[model samples]
Target chain A: MIGEARIVKLDNLTLLVIMVGTILAMSIFLPERFLTVTNFQSMSSQFPEYGLFAMAIMLTMITGGIDLSVVSVANLSGVAGALVLASHVKAQAMGISPGTIIFLAILAALVVSLICGWFNGLLITAVGVPAIIATLGTNGLFMGIAIILTEGHGIRGFPEEFLFIGSGTILGIPMPLIIFIGVALLVSLMLKKSAQGFKMYMLGSSPLVTRFSGISNNRVIVKTYLMSGLLAGIAAIIIISRVNSMRPGYGYAYLLLAVLLAILGGTNPEGGRGGVLGLCMAIVILQVLQSGLNILSFSPFLKKFIWGLILILFMVVNYYQTNGWPMRNLVRGGVKTGAS
Target chain B: MISKLFQRNETYLFFVIMAFSFFVTVMNPSFLTVENMFDLVKSSSGMAILAIAFFVGLLSRGIDISFPAIAIAGQYIAVNALIAMGVDSLPLAFLISCAVGTAMGATNAFFISSFRMQALIVTLGTSNIFHGALLVFVGTRAINTGKLPHCFKAFGHMNVLTLARPDGTLYGLSVFAVLLLFVIILTWFILNHTLLGKSIYAVGGNYESAKRAGFNIKRTLFFVYGYIGFLSGIMGVMHLSLIRYSNPNYIVDTELLRVIAAVVIGGARITGGSGTLTGTLLGVIMMVILEKNLVLIGLSSYWHQFFIGLVIVLGVSITYYQSKRQNRRNLLFTD
Candidate 1:
């Protein structure tokens, strides 16, 4: 437990340094635009959508699996929610209030996301397809379904109350930010304090051991994917509400970036290790870097290049730290790769 | 032997293709025509070639998502450089693109083998870097059909087999389809006859066992990725020539997944050390036929994506379960 805490703290310290240093540099270079309340508010509101996605992917990754279909699930769920809202908005004779429509929309999104996640899980656990491939298939299926339903067009114009979920502020703090915090805290608690947390970590670390220990690996993995879906649904709601548009191809760009953040937050692609606290920090760091770079008038392509470089650099350094260097491995009398 | 033969994904895929072709022909009599068949293979040649590259990656226990990006980048670089050199030689174009592709693929190899990181993320990072850098530094404008090299346009029109129709129109097998055959035969020779091919299978099956058995892990990684890069470079140029246009943004996004689907549907396991040439060829044919003839069979084109997804899931599932049934159950207790 002490070792885990120490390791977590060290990772947090690194993220903190990177975040603070980046903020300081950005403020110095582009203070007027980068250090404004409005800029901060916008950043806060924007990240919640993909931040939820990061959490979804993180859960699956912790199980030594990945859900590549997060973006498609988000879009599908958003489309589901949007269809409810759009149809009701058109049918004024239904006598449904705007509030009921928002609730119904949210419900539709949640139901679709859960089913998608469950399907992803069954594909992996029951059919025994690799997580990457299974999700890849589902990703196409979900995206195609959304496209067919929407007929390749975006559903736009939410009611004012529904729009508030995206843009509203509670006591001068943004609604999205608050919702994100609540969800983050709940996830952090789930990962850290719950017995299922132990099972997930165990499952990730050694599926063989978990299986022999009489723990149902299928149940845990399926549950993990289900949680992943729920998170994606939340992200869809946030995005659709904020942007006031739900389309078939929304959030595709976030797939790799979400994985990048998960890895940055100290999660292993091999499974059984990651933290909500670190993931949150990683999300904030990325959001700031994106906003800061925007303030400095960088092109979108350049931003992508920088992000790619950052991910590579981070992975290299993190790899060295986690696995130790070859020379260090020799000094410690460890085997090759130092993974075990 | 008979049981094992029937157990193959290729066998299942072959029957499915035959059935689908029957269905398509019944719905649209034109599908049975030689011209339509040639067109099908011609349109799918680039994909089949790329699917071979994908086969190598998946067999090595890694998925190379960056190949599409690398292919597009390589094609663009090679085209722009060739145009600058005032040359239109087809071989020279392939040589440049292949060289560039190998270097780019080798970059992925360098980071992955040296740092010992997960293959997916490293490739993801490199994919972004390569595509982003190309877009930012290189020009984004597409070279239209007329501006393309004369050799490329000519090659697009070249046919391996020609037959006269009663209406005096010509129809034949395409040169691009011949290229796919050459690629398939070449890959088959390498996989069946070379130590490098054996090493790829060994490494993919179990990295530790392969290393202990004296495989040069780094070399194996480099070769697979570089070879894939080499193949994609050719694919890039072939695609450019076949389409008679070069778009920097072409054959990316959903296109990459389609290639993956073809390879996977051919029974290539994501975990590695499986799949066959016959399966891959059939997979490519099935996907192409489905995509091209769906509208002719009274379904919207959008249904192709849905059906492709379904086939991938079903194919992988059936193959996995069949293979699983052959193995003994897991041990109940362990030391």
Candidate 2:
């Protein structure tokens, strides 16, 4: 019993170490600035966008599918949000309340993001295409649409009130960070305690078993995508509000980062495992690292360079631990006698 | 009947290529002029070379999305050596550039194969690394090789005649196009006739069985990725030669997706195994023609991506449906 308990304790410690390592690294690298309130505030606030994306993707990954198109949808939503707000500026100038306009803008973003996610889900389920391939196909499709809409230009001029959400804080807490925490809490409960969550994990692990047990695999797959899409919508809003501009090229940078966070946070890319709590913590750590590196006066290029190395290191480590190393052997063992 | 249908897979792609050629000629009028066709083939040669590299990865049920980033990095090293370091030797700089690309590819394969990481995830990570390295190498701007040795310039620009016209109208073909075709034919030949190629298909078709059959799965994967890297290295040299300059900010933009789609369109299933080099060449031609015509006919560049996506969806769907139908028809006729 004691050994079993210790093993359980180790599971949680993984998150603790990741979080602590990030914090410790930040404090060491930017001793004066990292520990300060201002930098902490910025770090916390930036976490929500990536954190939310991680959450959505984690849900789908738990069900044995990948959504490479989330970043593209986020980018499109950001641009769409800006385009909507820009068009409504004329109405705002004529004394329409700014709050109403912002509300509509967020609504537009949510709808667009959900539609994009649904599009991904629909194709994968209906056409029998694999998630990675389907998402990749749509990644190009959605990005194409976004680019066409933007004409290779950025959408700008969002209301200040919207910007405040991205940049605002309440009682020493940034709004985006608050959303990150709140979303993580909500999703953790949904995945851990909810029936739908259980079904998703089951489906991810064994579609046949789930179907034999009378579960709707298609529904589960679609719902996971929808959840991913919804969260991506929320992330898109945060990104737009924070950056104050939107471009078709917006989320290409964040797409892999989102996937890295999800995978490193312990979510299995092949599906059937992982939780949002670990993922949330991982995104925070990554954001903190990004912020610390930036504050340390590292050039953006260097930051990208180092960040990539770190992601690769983390991916390799995570992959080695879970997949048991020597991927060739894993493939050989798992796929015996199918074609060869 | 199924055998006949499978035999015609090559023919089907050939017809599609011809149809696209006809369409392009109709739209641009001068699209089929020898000069224009030669330029088209030359421009597409780089993408075709990279597509071959991409084909190897897809064949192994893996992906190498970092090719463009690797290409840029290779170009950066070559330019830096030739222009900044004042290296007068084109061959040396070119060789080093390819070596860099191969090194990057080796790194990706090592982590992904040894560490058991997802190929997509590993390549995605290294793609950024290569991108960052390029920025650092070029110092946030494009590197110009105008002052480099003349032989280097000729590698990208110099055209040799293959078949001249009686009227001296330069109806000859581009040597670069021939080089690209040679590479494609070599790839086809090796894939069709080599033990290594057969092992690759067996591994991709089913890794466990291949291993049980005594095939070295890791080694095969490593070779596939390594070859991909080598091809990218070659493509870097070709691209530098073709474009005559290297831009640090040269975004792959949609090139990676196109290459992947081209592989799939060429009858390579995403599930691995069962891919043909002939289909890949046809896919490359189809993509190049569509892109070339779209640009020549004055469509928005943004539309190029949209059409490419549409073509990929349609191409894959048609090939898949045709193959499925052919299988069913074979069963029906036999019964």
Candidate 3:
């Protein structure tokens, strides 16, 4: 409780401590079943997708923009990958080796996501549509295009080598987890060290001000969304590889959860403030909470209800920290009157 | 004159709607029928009501994704209570829905107004909370028509006007259309004539300026959100009557998106302080026709979501360019 109250001071290390403490506490609270290797392995596998999404959402949110279409872009990218990888796209007919085709599939998905992100960036920066509205529009546009192509059917059958990226363990660590860590580190380094990242923070704080400061606001904003799109593409590859199928209607479940996870990770919804460490911690906390809930057999609806309440609670906590406690003033006034 | 008309989003949309209807009619001659028009209005009444409600929130510089949840929960609670009391009166049910909805909206208002939380995030959180709580507390079993009261059934059947067909079957205009008209006029009067309405505009235009002007910011926010709740309640009852069924899951997510799209198409600025009832009605008409009568143009219903996405992107772009032009015109220096 004291640590939570101190987070109002906006110290990153304190927040990290709280997150680390939560993991430890939960372990102690649910030791016998939840602390096992299988449980840990399953959690490690599940969180990579969510963590990548949170990171993607975090990058966009850092620029005072949001990419609501990240899920759709992921689904679209997955479908793009699946189109090339699916057995129906005969290697014999195309006269291409399965190895080359798999490589092509990965490239195609990345290119598609880059284009989608560029499109989103253009809509917001060049067109001057607000980020929320622009992303909302593209959310439908991308999902609609994906649906049109796939007709809402699941595209299955990937080569084992490709599936290896999703399910295979590397030196006792899941491949997805390693990829996620690599991406997280790159994102953290970029945000903390790169000029473009500085420009993003400035743009988030105030676009007009950033423009006056000689930053090419549109370029920075576009690049932010573009990176966000790239991350979504990475998440999609992992998803299709893990699930061994790609479908257009597959990404809606992640949309809200991704947003929730990003907010939980301490990315301000209005933008300009976030860190990869906080984001990763948030992802771990949520994944652990989910695992704990599943172990306790909590219903999905109850879990949703709890997540919503926690989001609201955190929002309030954030508010009180920034603005000072209004209730405290009210209570102090009463205390003075009583003394008098 | 043409340039002046084209400068406004409303006129641009009006022209597009005209062209669209023309094409739809040329493809199928029955599109011009008054019967079809009446049917369009009647069928779209529920959506039109929600659009108007959505317009109110947008006008006050708030975006709400929770109205559908409120609409569903409000009606469900009201109907369930009515059923428990062994009563089946429509008016009482509507009143209960409004009360329940207003209460829910007040909770939203409390978070946003008191804490200055972002409307989108606050509503997003509330939407999940409201939905989950409803599903958790109340069972998700749908109330079928047989379980519904006679008043609701009668109201659902009630017509504002009736005309006999050549085949001797009567085609009647639904009361829902009249109700929609009433809601529109009521919103217009509130927006144009009432102090509370003007305050909404002022607050949306510039929050700090409105506060300086002595408008109670919290009060206005409370009213705006509470009114949304109140309207959602009414919509809930109307939906119950129209469907004559109470499904826990009805008109969520994409349906809400479509309404917001219609509102945007109608010329409601997401940043607030500018919109018109005529534009809103016209936008709703365009969406309804596209949704319901697209088969007349030999297209699949699957195409509508794509159209909606296109409409939103195009509509927002038009609005942005129009604002830019206006800004340029008002600029004193070339730089």
TM-score of chain A of each: 0.93, 0.87, 0.92
* Tens-digit per-residue lDDT, B90-197, candidate 1: 898889999989999999999888888777888888988988898899877899887787888888888999999999988888888778888988899888899989
Task: List per-prediction Cα lDDT, in the order shown.
Answer: 0.86, 0.77, 0.83
Clashing pairs in model 3?
none
Error of 1 at A99 (Å): 1.2
Categorize the docking of model 2. Answer: acceptable
Badly placed stretches (over 4 Å) of model 3 are A1-11, A87-89, A92-95, A327-340, B1-6, B328-335
Arranged by TM-score, best first: 1, 3, 2
Model 1: CA > 4 A from native = A1-5, A90-92, A326-340, B328-335
Better of 1 and 2 by TM-score: 1
TM values, all candidates: 0.95, 0.89, 0.94
Candidate 1 has an lDDT of 0.86
For TM-score, the strongest prediction is 1
User: TM-score of model 3's chain A, to 2 decimals?
Assistant: 0.92
Residue lDDT tens for model 3, A1-340: 3554355236466567767787898789989988898888888988888788778888999888788889888988988999988853478476777789778889989999999999999988667777888888888778777877777678887877889778989888888999999999999999989999888877777877887788888899889889999998999899999999997767576766777778777777777777788778778878888898898898777777787787788788777766778889899999999999
* lDDT by residue (tens digit), candidate 1, A1-340: 6776677688789988987888898889888898899998999998888888889989998999999999999999999999988876675567878888889999999999999999999988877777888898888888888988888889986777888899899887899999999999999899889988889989998998999899999999999999999999999998888888887887778987898899888887888889898898899889988997777689887877887888898888787877666787686776545756
Off by over 4 Å in 2: A1-11, A92-97, A323-340, B1-3, B6-13, B82-90, B137-141, B162-172, B295-298, B316-335
